[model samples]
Target: MNGRRTIGFLLLIGLVLWGCSGVHPTSNAVWIAQPEFSEVDNRLYSARIAPQKGESPYFSFFLLTLTNKSSVDLVVDWNASQYLFNGKPQGVMVFEGIDPEAVKNAMVPLDTVAPGASFSLEIMPMRLIAWSPIKEKTAAARSISPGMLPIGENGILLALRHGNGHITIPLSVRISREGLP
Candidate 1:
């Protein structure tokens, strides 16, 4: 009986350690979902933070998918929006393409989506990214570096506007990773 009890205790401890890791086993991107404020609709407009795929070694971006389930136009107010990282205010920039040198500290303008349409935006933390130029062989290239936030709970707060007032969506995620991969 004592031997069986000892084995059970070991198994319990192992399971606890595994749970503490808190990482997605299969997919590359994993965000701990927020039960509230994740998905909201201002009568006719709706928005949600879609899952991000294809994470880079120096990861610093979020893919947000917005849908207009109503029959009218909606606008994503970037001016009234904010990025929430680790429960703090973070500046963000939305842009197209994957060029590292092209990304700047400027935020993307407001998005006006037609009725019954869906779209996605690739957003990155402005201050969380660092740029450096390096010359190799005979050419100079720029590299986008990651911030100190390698592991923690981080997310973004989005603002959507219409003819009336506006609605806010807050997405929080739990991040776990090795330091600076």
Candidate 2:
């Protein structure tokens, strides 16, 4: 009788732990959906071909959606990065110590997103040309060498840092064979 009781107790504990991971069941306020390669917008987010003046290029535009989840107002710092499925890091994007003017342009910050409520920022697309020379140099340093394939696209992981921990979001990128202008 005791042996059966122990097995049942273990199973109950496992179920509770699994439920607490708190991952959203759907792409709602609790969860953010990662963009996939086939996901369409004319702008090529990661491309190899040098952009012409009129070409539609894509760059990292910060989009923040904050949900307090807890009963109390949550004030937290946010950060993001990209990586491959095998745990190899592709790139990291951080906002720490960045100039206020630049962040103001890239992000839409909220003093308080409010409990159980969310705030979002749909940033304007940025072009590759706007990145600093240092950014370009770093891209070259990576063995992959930042270049978008006409068809090949990769998935990236995004990390949002807050309160000594983080929530990660996944994203994917693909370049169209069809040229953009």
C-alpha TM-score for every candidate: 0.57, 0.33
Clashes of 2: 2
lDDT tens digits, residue span 17-81, model 1: 99888764433433333332255556575666533433543235666778787777778876556
TM-score of 2: 0.33
Which regions in candidate 1 have their CA more than 4 angstroms from the true location?
A: 1-43, 51-55, 97-108, 131-149, 178-181
Per-residue lDDT of candidate 2, residues 1-181 (tens digit): 9999999999999999989877533312221222422121122111111111121233223333444555545443322344332344444333223333544454534244455655443222221113344444453342111222122343435444434455454545433333222
lDDT of 1 at 147: 46
Model 2 residue pairs with clashes: 47-148, 48-148
For all candidates in order, the CA lDDT equals: 0.60, 0.37
